[model samples]
Target: MQNNKKVIVGISGGVDSSVCALMLKSAGFDVQGVFMKNWTNSAPNIECTTEKDFADAEAVCDQIGIPLHQANFSGDYWDRVFKKFLSDHNEGLTPNPDILCNKEIKFRAFLDYCLEIGADYIATGHYVRVDNSGSSARLLRGIDPTKDQSYFLHQVTGKDLAKSLFPLGELTKEQVRQIAKDNKLITAGKKDSVGICFIGKNKYNDFIANFLGKDPGAILDEEGNELGVHDGLMYFTLGQRQGIGLGGIKGKEQDSWYVAHKDTQSKALTVVQGRDHPLLFSDGCYVEDVQWVNENNQEELNCEVQIRYQSQPVKAQLKKLTNGYKIIFASPQLAVTPGQSAVIYQGDDCLGGSVIKDRISSDFYSWADNRGYNYQVYG
Candidate 1:
């Protein structure tokens, strides 16, 4: 009954992970609960809830009659995940810290620690399934489409996949919550954590300002007309329609405005009139730091790529580059922001993904080509 195999489940003091521990214990595995303390630094306007999470994790472990292990990965997280997150934003790119956390913290640090303690494998409540029937493990989208987390996990290496488990992969959010409720787990009704990894419920603007103070700049229109002033260029991202703080500008329509692009050279945030503005769509994109999962190391292949989590996968042609790959979308993609992951997949198989380095917009391409503008310079 696999009772001899020790499985260390990372308990995050949430319903999903709480239920994950319950399911693993019920399955007769030698289950142990581990609470990863990845963030401990104090920041103004940001609440550090590690103590509360630790207590909840402890209560769950006690209820399950399993020993709970705790480790401080704050140093490793700062070095590997938090630094890169700040660096990406500093470079005017919107980075996904969750992707880095999964790779560096949960899968790398936590996995290594568990293995060192004689655990056969480490599991999380990530809603993604792994297929080990083949010679190499394959990552698949969770059965619950609404909650599938494979996009964030595409950076995980093949070797790590083999030693990982996802007990809630086949269960929906409702099912996991129901299981927790049935077991009377303290986290049965706890809301899922969102926003920055480990820094709970912190406002993005305040968090960024606390770490890296604002570099205020002008908000401009597509034609280079200044509409208003912004706190910083790094504070906004592509496709953002809110927080522009501009209204009733003369000569401009009352329609909603969205962030179309950023001119880092001039320190300007460009705005378009509407959500479907041509500047928001891209025909293709350039990706960097790709990691393949199924050993598909081909130079080029046809696949579907997801630009962000919860987005529908779009058909694309993958052209391998020395450092990354060129993703030419069959159809124009919306809001393909730099530094966010471009996860490639063929059906349900998560081939791999990389950071979106650049994108080719037909509107921008033509506008630049006719004017003989250099793409590199414009980028």
Candidate 2:
């Protein structure tokens, strides 16, 4: 038992965090629950779930016989996370708001609060393991591969890793649910929250349209042929297969038209029909704005690369570029979309990662050769 160690656990009123607080408390640590209030204002007709979450957290704290504190971080969330998300989308890039929230709000502001309250450590329900040894700290993937969240946490620094604790890293989702059930926790049967935090269950397109004006654009097939019109170029992402309305080309032909490119200049969405071999694959990509948790200079490091959260880790050769780094995959990858993050890892340990700037492959530019097709063919 860790006797007399003061630990502050960030409780989101979810089963994972609630279990984390219970685990820490059972271990004899002086664990206090803190619910982070990050959103100040609410959107029209949208219910703010913060009150429910707070009440649930307070119930858990009472059940576990601990004190609960509330920290309001509305200003930081807007200025640091939400604003950057808007700017990144406006500039035609996919941004991960969760990463920014972890970097700026949760770790930075919450850690400050922990220090102010004379806590020795800050804990969360994140499904990532933290290891501190050999003169430094390391972050590793959780035991459950499906529920592992190390990809979104690559931005955490070594300093943050040292003082952080993850109680749910060794458990699977089922195990966490069982723990909550055994303890009769309020969030035992709660459905997992999806999409952006604070925004609740609102559709992504609807949320973006509130800040980013509706600038509809033409959806062009490969060879600059117009297939249909899209709601907005910014709303659609690379390699999107669904939601593009093309008449009569349903079943097989419509399935062929996967988004291959986005022309920001013309505000056009470019797609390729049929199983086009060349345009569907990429060797790897160039990633910029890299951050490393283990090493200061990521000049020489070999690690597995994860292009997206759901993507499997692939073997790659990493080389530091002027701004970031270039990753060459062992096998050809499909739809290495720009605006997504490319997180690198060594075994279970996450080294660092960067945002995807551009894709580099021999077959990526082959679609531009066919220029004879009419832009109004599908219109």
Using TM-score, give the best candidate's number. Answer: 1
User: Which regions of candidate 1 fall more than 4 Å away from where they truly are?
Assistant: 368-374, 377-379
Error of 2 at 185 (Å): 1.2
Tens digits of per-residue lDDT, candidate 1, 150-202, equal 99999888789999999888999999988988889889988888867665777
TM-score of each: 0.96, 0.93
Cα RMSD for candidate 1?
A: 1.9
**RMSD for each of the candidates:** 1.9, 4.3
Colliding pairs, model 2: 226-375
lDDT for residue 107 in candidate 2, whole number 0-100: 86
Q: Where does candidate 2 have its weakest 10-residue lDDT segment?
A: 370-379
lDDT (10s digit) by residue, model 2, range 172-262: 9999999999999888998888777866877777777778877778887665656688877778777767666665653335445677777
Query: What's the residue-level lDDT of 187 in candidate 1?
Result: 90
lDDT of 1: 0.86
